[model samples]
Target: MDSQIRSVLPKTDFNRRSFVVTSIAAGFALAVLPVGAATITTDTTGLVAGEVKIPVKGGEIPAYRALPVNGGNNLPVVLIVHEIFGVHEHIQDLCRRYAKLGYYAIAPDLYARQGDVKKLTSIQDIVTKVVSKTPDEQVLLDLDATVAYLAGKANTDKLAVTGFCWGGRIVWLYAAHNPKVKAAGAWYGRLVGDTDPNHPENPIDIASKLKVPVLGLYGGKDQGIPLASIEQMRRVLKEAGNPSEIVVYSQAEHGFNADYRPSYNPEAAKDAQQKLLAWFKKYGVA
Candidate 1:
């Protein structure tokens, strides 16, 4: 951890007995072992970056926050929802990236109440034990709590949200849930899926109801998310007269922006990031 990171971290004894996943893990999750050679690491130089506690419903949840060292109050806020692997190194690095770009970025451990997925070695096991059991309502509430935590620290009115994988799906729901959000960038999130009590709606279900403009970045070759579903979402948005747009990278796969994964696509990731920033700026979130 950088000295700046240590300085900003809450001065509290974060032990396992006190909270689930008391602190952010050092590296990638066990499930994504053998870190890719292209893994990107963002240093906390000239930035206040580290772990902080977000007061939620039942209790507090651990969250990683990063922002400019000299940035005063009312900075633009960007909420980064994590992948199924949790808020590991990649997500932390992403926060730093946003901080470098003059945004107050935060990524809360939405799975803190359930279980730590970092220790789990298999993807399926993590999904069954942690992800599957997590309720969408709880996740949204936690996000609201996170924003509440920001109160005077950042400008909530200029709020923007972006997520990946599991978190990507959440970006859509959150936009519909919170009208204060100015813009959102969803990367490779599922558009359609079976409805259940925990997850009663997908992005497709709420396409027509979305008031906030959203930019959906999808991978054409993503096996998990079919192109047809993306088309359906686009149709719904268009029919509803929504300003949202979906862009597909024909050569990219899922997680193309995750530099620490095998699915990472440098070209696509770079372009998508540029588009996300432009989207945020276009919608007055910058």
Candidate 2:
């Protein structure tokens, strides 16, 4: 598919009300294997963890969800979108980490509707075959549906979104799309890009329209995301009323938070996590 992805939600009869529950009963795990770092994997001993099929446009897309041991009403929900590599092991572990933090987190395989990037050998192939073909509008709608699913299960009033690499840009778009969101944390996502009619805009373009508070965590050494682009994005955000903040760690590079990656910076990751917690709490997502 050379062109941007066509709308997939409406075609699937996208239903959020009963989607999460229907997925809750389904089996999941071993969708992908470990590749790098001592990727943190939290036990689901006292928690609800498994695979679920989110009802999308026509067919249901598979995803992994994790929640607290003692489930209650209206728990804060975090939509954990994945990097360009897709919703593999690292992404699933992230959902568990958020679950440990008391938030019901879900990592939907957004790429499932397209193709599994994990099966592809090269990142370049993954980008061209999967990522590029993905439409921005589709991602926003899927995430919105995920929120609605969680809202039905827990309180979504304190909703927050977090994404890594490719997902980081999505966090920005979601914050702009949903005013109900309390906050968002974007990790080293791209700032600018070419526009298409199907893929209408980029994060920098949406800075002025952003409605919710967002914390952008970036790396100065990142090859793909230059400091200048980050600065330009900052300028745009400052010009807007939201004043969303972006932090660039001089020593870090892209995927610094992913322990499995060579560029993972322990200090930077810990500090960023602290700030992310504080940001969420300040914005009421805690």
Candidate 3:
């Protein structure tokens, strides 16, 4: 574990609220609120699904947690980092899907400290005012808090992480930050970008420091993330002797896994999900 991660972990378990976002946001993020018929909704009939609050420094952040109703503490943990849209229905559904597979999946609202992107109508505004303001340090601490919160409740030792879009970028950083993470699945996240005051590094920058193997799923046609960057990331990983792999779907575009969005690609999304499950099991995250 890194020194910073060591410092943020809860020294002792403390009492905390059950859930925060009691009622999930009505629909998809306002920026891309269009309702597509392909949206996938996972049920919670066999699992405990709903909001859960994670205690942080001075306050608490809300998260969606789903675990098997009968697994108790035997379930593996999968931290589902949400897209820039926040912990909306899609994210919660993902938690349920993981729970159905005997994994305790939790998706914390990483942007809680900055602002809620779900309510904002413009994607650019959400990026500028909310996502941009959220410090990487804060996001990492909140995730650590979430893991600490589930210390005794879930099989934390078999930990895996998966994130989409903006959260995809975080999957890389989290794997680098926490050595205990068994594996990570990053979906169409930017591999390289200009550094700012809050975010000083990209996935390419820390490829050499990654202790956890990352299964990076990308789309060659992704407009926001150029193919050159992905190639660069591959070069960095190889040079660093890292075993990470990046799989690019030549025909898919960014947000291909987002079932509710126009960019959603059912074929690619299904293949990626299967690949993710296999990757986790291969890396001992099961």
Q: Is candidate 1 or candidate 3 better by TM-score?
A: 1
Q: Which pairs of residues clash in candidate 2, taking residues 3 or more apart in a chain or in different chains?
A: 9-57, 11-57, 12-57, 12-58, 13-57, 36-260, 37-260, 74-154, 74-155
Q: What is the alpha-carbon lDDT for the whole of candidate 3?
A: 0.83
- Candidate 2 local lDDT, 1-286, one digit each (tens): 1112223322222233322222222211222234455556667877888787666665566778889878686689888988877777677778888988999889887766556676676666766666666667778887776766665788888788899988998898888898998889999987786666545777888899999888999888888787888999999888886758998899998889987666789889999999998999998887
Better of 1 and 2 by TM-score: 1
Better of 2 and 3 by lDDT: 3
> What tens-digit string does per-residue lDDT give for candidate 3 at 175-268?
9999999999999988877766567778888999999999999987888888889999999999999989999999999999998988999999
Clashing pairs in 3: 19-51, 19-52
Q: Which candidate gets the maximum TM-score versus the true structure?
A: 1
Number of residue pairs clashing in candidate 3, backbone atoms closer than 3 angstroms, sequence gap of 3 or more or interchain: 2
lDDT of 1 by residue, 10-57 (tens): 222222234466678778899999889999999999999999998876
**Could you report the Cα RMSD, in angstroms, for every candidate shown?**
7.6, 4.9, 6.0
Best by lDDT: 1
